[model samples]
Each structure stands twice: as structure tokens, then as C-alpha cells.
Target: PPGISMAEEARYGFGQPATEADIKAWNIDITPTGEGLPPGRGTVRQGAAVYSNKCAACHGPTGTEGPKDRLVGGHGSLATEHPVKTIGSYWPYATTLYDYIFRAMPFTAPQSLTADEVYSLVAWLLHQNGIIPATMVVDAQTLPNVTMPNRDGFVADPRPDVESRE
Candidate 1:
């Protein structure tokens, strides 16, 4: 081990540069089909409590705001010259909603919510957006089944073309 540094040895000691275990630990993604979703459930009513306690101040009650970004409403604005891109009118993926909420929501306390809380928040937002019924409970099984109105509105990015060259 003469002339071999500890740092060099440590770098070269691994069999694979990165193992599946490492990748899996870091990649905590939930799919649109509810795959990888955690076990929990939240009703719209429960989400209302959660939202008021954790979310409303920043997102505004009922998701409408005088200053902050709106999380709901603005449905059927896709054809307008200036559309208000809210969850109801723009987002195409329900899993993205869950993922975003789980990872970065409640602005003041990011990532502070439980999986159930996240599900509840998603349910409440979707309901406010008019995408889901208010009485429904959002869980691993039900979250994915709530079809978004703009689900098919987005066309695949036909990129590498002239318009996208900028």
C-alpha cells in the first residue's frame, strides 16, 4: 500500500460505481398508475383541515390568491390568449401533483407532510380544480384514477424541429 493514498483506495474499492440500492434510495418517484405510492388515505374534508393548517396562508384559501400562485381553478383557459395555468387547466399528470406536493409544497415547510397528507392535499386541490368529486378520498389506489381534464390536452413535444431550435 506504499504510495497509495486512502482517498484513492476508497474511490477504487467499489465494485459498481453506483449500486441499485443507492439509486433506489435516492429515486423515490411515484408513478401515474400509483406504483411506488405509500399506504395512506385522505378525504377532501381532511385535506381541508390539512390545507388550512399547512397550506392556505401561502396558496390562499380555496386556492385563489391576490398575490401567490393559484393551485386550483382556471379551468377551460387553454384556448385563451393568456391562460392561467392552474392544476385544473394545465397539469396532465396526477402523479406529478403528488410528487410535487410531497417534495416541495407548503412553501414554509417543504417536505414536511406525511404521505397521507400529500394524498389529502392532492385530493383537495383536484376537487377545488373541479377535477374530482369533493366526497372522494385520495389514496394510493384512488389518486391515479382521478382523471385530469387537461389529460389529453398536451401533445408530445415534437422536438429537434425548427420551432424548438432556439
Candidate 2:
């Protein structure tokens, strides 16, 4: 800490200074209504190709991994005695799925996919989960339209006693 200069310390204390342009460049937030979704489309079939080329090694061929994270097909298992929560059944919002995968997926390499490639991957995963048809193309227009089965399953946290009473 002695080597740290006053100016450097001041800059650090000021925290990260980000510009609007910088924020715009890195801001990739996608809403549940498809707001901020990029312009692109990908079919389930195309996604299979993309996955094999970009995601298969880490996520496994069928999305069930031997060593890495599993990305698909664990529906109806969450309520069972032994549950394996997956994107198929556990995820409440499809848009969140797309946003998450687009931002951080493939483990080692994150944010390495184009908008179209992300859409393709989403389509593939949704199709694998039986949430969407294989022929469906996931895009900004349609991605938000797909109704997730567990959309209403989660309840808002009611912590009135803990916060108010405490």
C-alpha cells in the first residue's frame, strides 16, 4: 500500500468512472418482454450445429454433462425425491435464460457468441426441453412470446415480519 500514489489512491477511491458510451457498449440487458433484445434469429436445427461447434465440449452432446454443467432436459424432476433442476423446468423466465446464456455460457469462453448464435442456442435448448417446436426460430420478436410453464410458480418474497418487526 506504501507504493500506491495519492492520485492513484484518489482514483481508486472515486471508484470506476464509466461513460454513457461505455455503458451502452457493455449493457446487454434483455427484459422479459424482449426489450433490449438484439436483431437476429436462429432455428433449433441451426442451434444444434452451433452447439456442436461452440458448446458441446463443455455442456455435453445432449446437454447432460460428464464433467461440465448440464444445459437441458431435466423436466419434471424437480418435484421428485431426487431432483435435477435444469433450464427446462427450473427457470422461470425464458428471457432470463437468453440473457444469461448470451452473457455467460460455454464456461471457459463467455460472451463469445453473436446475437444470432445466442438465439440459436436458446431455440435449441427450448426445443430440447419440449417448451418450443424444433422449427421455431428464436428472435427478439418471438423470444419473449414463448410462455414458460413455470412462469407463475415462483412467489415474491414476503419478508414483512423480518424487516418491519425487527
* Cα displacement (Å) at residue 113, model 1: 0.5
* Backbone clash numbers for all candidates listed: 0, 0
Which pairs of residues have clashing backbones in candidate 2?
none
What tens-digit string does per-residue lDDT give for candidate 1 at 1-166?
A: 6897888887756575688899866666788787878888887888899988888888888888825788887787779987889988899888888888877877767778898888888888888888889899888888888788888988778877666544
lDDT on C-alpha atoms for all candidate structures: 0.83, 0.85
**How do the residues 27-105 of candidate 2 rate in per-residue lDDT, one tens digit apiece?**
8989999888998899999999999988888778888873576767767787789877777878888999789988887
What ranges in model 2 sit over 4 Å off? Answer: 1-20, 159-166
